[model samples]
Target: MTRRRLFVGLMVVALIVCMSTTLFGAASVRRYAYSASNPGGVWYTMCGGIVKLLQEKLPSNIRVDMIASGGSVLNTRRLASGEADLTMAYSTHLWECWNGEGIMKGRPNDNPRIMFEIYKSDHYFVTLANSGIKSMKDLEGKRVVLGPPGSGSSDNSRFTLRTLGINAIESELAFGDAAQALAEGKVHAMGMSGSPAAGLVEVAATRDIYIIPFTDEELDKIVSAGPFFSKGVMPANTYQGQTKDVPVFMFTVYQVASKNVPADDVYEMMKVCFSPEGKEYLGAVHPYWKTMKNDPELVKALGIPYHPGAERFWREQEQKK
Candidate 1:
């Protein structure tokens, strides 16, 4: 009877162990990697803010981490390779990568599916106020810094110059260094793309600055180059400047995910990001977030297919209306 009792006790312990494994294993954490641009850029900060929101609002078992990367072009490649679970990239690059055109020629990436439209990145072609470089036409035969190589800003700069038929002596530099070059008169103008970049603000703090505006005819020709380009206006006083409204070409920025990621996780992320609380938190993190809208129409306009999870979220939102 003692031996029988010992066997029964062992069975009971085994049962408990089975139950414990089932209970605890169900809540095991999942980690996802999010890729963004280099540190000190708006994309990196925006990714950090998003990861923080996901941490706060997602189920405790899910965690997201950020990876610093080389802007949009490289981020698209990372998404294609499954090296990044989530990434932020311009709509122009997304279209190019998916279609296997332009810089992404002959190597298509069909894995990236859009999560949402992040914001509009306006082009800022800044020069010293006293430089006498008043227009895009004036940039011809002059030295310019067109962001770092492979960056979205650089691509846009090249596209715009090509479309406008201007041949400027172009060099690639990081945004901060480009701003400093502009201030020190090393470059005639610096073409940057952002919603009033911090580097531009710093340069303006120390020297008189001017943002070269595009004429209506020039804006029309540039936007005609691609469906991704659109007309945008930089409001007066976006930077410390002797100000007036500035017409600029702009492109949409999108948050996309690898198709292999679980649909439910992306759905949950969308819910958290578009929630009133989440938007408020992100807007507080950067003024750019304030420009974000919950509208799925903008995402639909991008011509890229949405992730199944994101599509589900948007469909439900539409049903609620």
Candidate 2:
């Protein structure tokens, strides 16, 4: 009886040792949640590509997961609340969040730090070719879908219309749903931002589309409205039935990290994202990635500070040049 008891006690000790090892191994892997826009949008696709690249390049102990949220405004909130470790937001929105101005007034969130400028998101005002809405002025009484609620695109659309004194009935919808509404004639126009938006491409596939370009005077008013606004051109053939260059007001989209994130991790992420392998992979994922550059001047133009890790990485790049 004594010998049998001894053997059972030894087995119990071994089992506890195995369980402890398993728990420790699981705890050692640090997973970070990255916030981005809803699926079926360019931001969503590009962010997925970035997360995949990070997963492959980052150490096995560090994992990054992408979470789909409303858009820029919500993403910023998430970063400030510690709900997200990284996020994508517009330069205008980031500036407001940092300075406690505009929509972010009285709720300043200074924790967001720029990692890099992702791409130029040009505003697109799309209408069906037969709608007869040839310019921004013509949409005064028309129903317009102004992007999802709390999205940067929505804020931008409202600001542009208000600045130019063009008031239209506005509806907030996701990119895919908005495209469907436009196709069904439920809405007269839709506003979108991003390079070669997937929703616009999908809509153009079935119906002839017209992108209303901003006039020279309108561009001047938009640029004068804020430092974040700039004139941009959408190249000819950017979409089906678009045969000429379309002038548009644009804003920069940036990837930002929380200040709580370790500087070393942010630095490593910048290194992997800017590496030749990373660029090739991202460019293939979307044409927007091709717009990314190593220029620190662009970061400076954001009018906000960079993550220490990102700043360190950029400083090294500057020295190499």
Candidate No. with top TM-score: 2
Clashes in model 2: which pairs? none
- TM-scores across all candidates? 0.87, 0.94
Query: Clash number for model 2?
Result: 0
**Per-residue lDDT over 152-193 for candidate 1, one digit per residue giving the tens place of the 0 to 100 score:** 888888888999999999998877778888899999998877
Q: Write the per-residue lDDT of candidate 2 for residues 1-321, one digit (tens) a residue.
A: 998999999999999999999999999888889997876467878888999999999988889999888788788878877899998888888888887888678888778898888887898689999999999999999999988887877888888899999989999999889988999999999888885888889889999999998999999999999668899999999999899999999888888999989898999899888999998999998988888765467667666788999999988988998
Which numbered prediction scores highest in lDDT against the true structure? 2
Please provide the root mean square deviation of candidate 2 (C-alpha atoms, Å).
1.8
- RMSD of every prediction: 3.7, 1.8
Q: Provide the overall lDDT of each model, using Cα atoms, as 2-decimal numbers.
A: 0.84, 0.87
